[model samples]
Target: MIWKTIKVNFHRLGSPPTFYRLAEVLAPWLWGGFAVCAAIGLYQALYVVPPDYQQSDSFRILYIHVPSAWQAMAGYVVMTILAVIALVWRIRTVEIMAMAGAPIGAAFTFICLATGSLWGRPMWGTWWAWDARLTSMLVLLFIYLGIMGLYAAFEDRRKGARVACILILVGIVNIPIIHFSVEWWTTLHQGATIRLFSGESTLHESMMPPLVWMTIAVKLMFGAALLDRARNDLLDQDRRKGWVQSRLGETA
Candidate 1:
């Protein structure tokens, strides 16, 4: 009974109009959470967390570097899942989600690479390295670029979406490589600081709270950005439809 109920609701919300309305309702809350949490996280990260014994203040880069890396990979997984839905179910809204998600994911991946390089300069005494984690992450960024480029190449948007979906599915393999590269091979990068199974983290108590807050803040920010992008894509997709015409008329 519960599964049937969930299936019904999922289909109902899958409709473009319903999803647009839901996005509208969610946008403010997501942005508000992002603002509050980010402010608190920044305060704690800058003032509360003490300097590292080895790296000193340079260690502070993890606050930005860690969250950006996590979010970058997370965004790709989200795009891949939505792409699968679009491909299997032939849902236009999900297709738009997949399309809209790519640029955002790409942006985060770029940030991850940039910040990681900045962190490395002070610690590794170099601007870049062909380390396993870094190389895999660079490949992830190139995949993102390829997806975007492929989608833009076709004048027929539907055909473009189909091809992009296939590319995303293929690129899903790199995500695991990025996550385990530090463990699988020797690298300048450190191992995981936080463990999910055990309540174990390498960070001190003062540092952990800010890191936690920053992670949540980044996720919320991603949600807000994704919804905003999806909403805009829906507008572009449905511009010729009666509902969008009426909505535009009312606003005008």
Candidate 2:
């Protein structure tokens, strides 16, 4: 019964109008959640948590860096799932959503790289290093840019999205590489401080709260931004359709 209901809703979401309306309704709530969570996370990270003995206040940067890195990878995984659905089902809404995720993922990757660099300069005595983790993350950013460029290169958006979906599938390898780079290679980047599967964490309990809050905030931000972008893409793609025309007429 549950599976049948899910299948029904999934088909309903493939309808452009249904998807657009859902995006419109959910995005604002997601954005609100992001704002509240981020405010609380920032407060806790900056004032509530004590500084590391070795890194001092500089460790606070991890609160932002870790979440951005996490969301960057998580966003790509979401795009990959959407891409697979698009390729197999030829669902136009899924294709647009897959494409919409690239820029947002790229933005998060940029933040991760930028903040990592800022954190590194003091710790590693260099602004940049070709460390395994850092190098793989840089590659991830390039892949994101390449996907966006490929999609734009074609005049037909659907065709472009199809080609880009293939690229998204191909790039899935990098995510695992990024995750395991620290374990596989000697690098300045630290290994996992918080382990999910093992239930073993090296990080102090007090520091965990801000990280948890910030992680949730970024996830919310990603969802909100993705839906907004997908909705805009849908509107632009369907501008000539009667539903879109009616929506514009109503808005006007």
Q: Compose the digit string of candidate 2's lDDT tens values, residues 1-252.
A: 999999999899999999999999999999999999999999999999999999999999999999999999999999999999999999999999999999999999999999999989999999999999999999999999999999999999999999999999999999999999999999888898889998689999999999999999999999999999999999998999999999999999
TM-score to true structure, per model: 0.94, 0.97
Instruction: Give the Cα error of residue 104 in candidate 1, in Å.
Output: 1.2
> What TM-score does candidate 2 get on C-alpha atoms?
0.97
Q: In terms of TM-score, which candidate is strongest?
A: 2
* Model 2: lDDT to the true structure: 0.97
lDDT (tens digit, per residue) of candidate 1 on 26-142: 988999999999999999998988888998898887888889889989999999999999999988778878888788888888888898889889888898999999999999989
Measured on C-alpha atoms, candidate 1 has an lDDT of 0.89
Q: Tell me the deviation in Å of residue 48 in model 1.
A: 1.4
Worst 10 residues of 1 by lDDT: 198-207
